[model samples]
Target: MLPVLPLFVLTVILSVVSKPVVIRDSQFNLPVVRKLNFTGESTIPELDRARSQSILKRPTRIVHGDAARAVFDVAATNEALQYVTSVGVGTPPTNYTLIVDTGSANTWLGAMKPYVRTNSSVDTGQQVSMTYPSGSFSGEEFTDRLSLGSFNVTVQGLGVASRSIGFENVDGVLGLGPANLTIGTLFPDTEATIPTVTDTGFAQGVLTAHEVSISFQPTTEEVNVNGVVTFGGNNPSRFNNPISFVPLTATSPSKDFIGINQTITYGTSGFPILANAAGIIDAGTTLLLLATDTLQRYLTVVGGSNEPDPETGFYTISPANFARLQSLFFTIGDTAYEFTANAQIWPRSLNTAIGGNPNTIYLITADLGTRSGSGLDFMNGMVWLERFYFIYDVGAGEVGFATTPFTHATTN
Candidate 1:
């Protein structure tokens, strides 16, 4: 287990509950945003690249197998590659904005905002510490009353960080991934398993199913909090058609998280870009990252050149052949999902935000740093998720996707 030191505790109100409201038996959805410039970055694209690179180093967990899990969804926007949401911690809760992430578990506080002592806060006498690709935190573990959407979890385990780095302008994170990912994140409690909000919700009968579904929409704006995360159930209104579900890929590294298997082909020429590779769908990543081989084929077929901008680290294409770009097709579980040409590029109107020539078009896909056959090849991040409705069904051991209204929009 990682070493840790004691962090001071806050005086929390230990006894407060909302008017006895009946939590919904079905799905609960809430909106989130892609926070920008939280770390004083000049542009959204630069932040996106940094966040994605940070994500690449932190695999969700080192666990070896899959397990039964539950779910809940949160709304998110596309900004700086980090999704933000509001969470109420403690009693008579002090609302703190947090990152809605699937990459890590163990909800914590005290990055930008100090933890408010509440009537519901109880220190568990254990020191907690977690290291991410972007930041690290050391604090004390506490059980508190946390609320979100229409539900609240009593005794929700959380951390109050006394020391932190990389995370700025945010209180902490609302982990939406598996519970087992929290293993070994705390000292003295290293052998203990910390239950996530979803786990607590399911065990407390606040959620019907042990799963959460995420519905993300494509946005062309620099910043917009316009997406929904559905807990306990799927939202048909968010999807344009029936959903297709595929079992999690059995490949190592990938299987320990939300992994899936799919093949990719480029446009009308039917050129294969990826051949049945295993990868993951992560909310924490900003770009659609593919293995080196697949990215080369994509850039080649699109007639685009790799000209990385120092500001954003993304390849830029001249406007001349941009119209010649074709859609990328993904075949998952016998279903073919077409990624529109426009969906592959950054919003041209927001070009200046990333310190790029306003007239130039940049592709949202990037190289994943390694080749195929590494067990984990591609990462369908915000760019890809925005084009489809995604569901991470933990209890069912599958992932679901459907086309959205903005699936074919040329807004970019």
Candidate 2:
């Protein structure tokens, strides 16, 4: 995915839950932008609750695997909302998902006009519905402090595509991966919820390497804020292990995302790896996807080979390369952990390698362009993130690598 052809950044125009909101306070401003990863003992073992607390009064949890899929929150100013609008080639502008996706970079939601319900038309009031493949829901267009623990994003302009996708617990998605015109901008408040980028002077571009933190949001209580998700910095805990922190960089629509950027180290020498890995942190996606070139390089280190695809501009791989695989590792700040190869990788075939006798654990299908799949794996999914702890720090534009797969008794 070279780059998302600068889609008209379309943020949902939300009605203010509270009117005349004041955003003059810079207390929410991230003071520093560190360029490193942190490695240390995870206090995560001690944390055992449906949610944690935070100071800024938000929600915090190291969402991993299934728990991390297609679930995110976004906050932008009215000006930032304008940055999302754009004029489609032959169509009018529509708001997409200002999703803070981790599995994949680039912010995009369902693009459709203010879809009115069928049957009735004439006297029906203009209603918006942001539906997923699952059921139907409603997004109450209102402006409230889009809060998540300490992370306070004042999106003066936003709307709720009430149409439900998959889960009912999630309201909407927030794109934290790359810096497309999806996050910031200034424009005239048009009558429409939020216009496309073509006519709006709002924000239209990409951004990366920023700080985004989350505090646990409980049903009734002030959340504690501290677990900060910096673009590339150490977690301040467990500072001994040689954790590799990736450098944060800017990105395009289709590629990297709002908070997606980092420096990675692998092999004995610990040379930098996956500088552009930021673009591929997608929650909607179950496997870690990379361009064929990048995939080949990573597979090469692990003895994986590739085949020819004829049209898809790629080839096939051996199943063993994906099957009994090595533990894949990623670092957010300084923390580092190994990923289960068996769960993360599931290649296309078992014996379709073009060369080098390498194998794959996951399958790279043609549906990546669109989240479309069928059959058992799609139904009774045993994939990596079928249910896991994944964190997407949109403000900082980086996704945290952690999961609560075990409720084990560990060495303190």
Quick one: best lDDT, which candidate?
1
lDDT, candidate 2, at 144: 22
Each candidate structure's TM-score, on Cα atoms with residue i matched to residue i, is 0.86, 0.36
**Model 1 weakest lDDT span, ten residues long:** 1-10
RMSD of each: 7.1, 17.2
Task: Indicate which candidate wins on TM-score.
Answer: 1
In angstroms, give how far residue 376 of model 1 lies from its true place. Answer: 0.9
User: What are the runs in model 2 whose C-alpha is more than 4 Å off?
Assistant: 1-256, 263-280, 303-305, 308-324, 347-388, 393-399, 406-412
Q: Model 2: per-residue lDDT, tens digit, 123-197?
A: 213343332222223443332222321222232223435354332222234333222232222122212332221
What 10-residue stretch in candidate 2 is worst by lDDT?
Answer: 47-56
Overlapping backbone residue pairs in candidate 2 total: 133
Q: What is the C-alpha lDDT profile of model 1 across 106-166, one tens digit per residue?
A: 7888988999988899999999988764568899999999877655789999999999877
lDDT of model 2 at residue 205? 13
Query: Candidate 1: deviation at residue 370, Å?
Result: 1.3
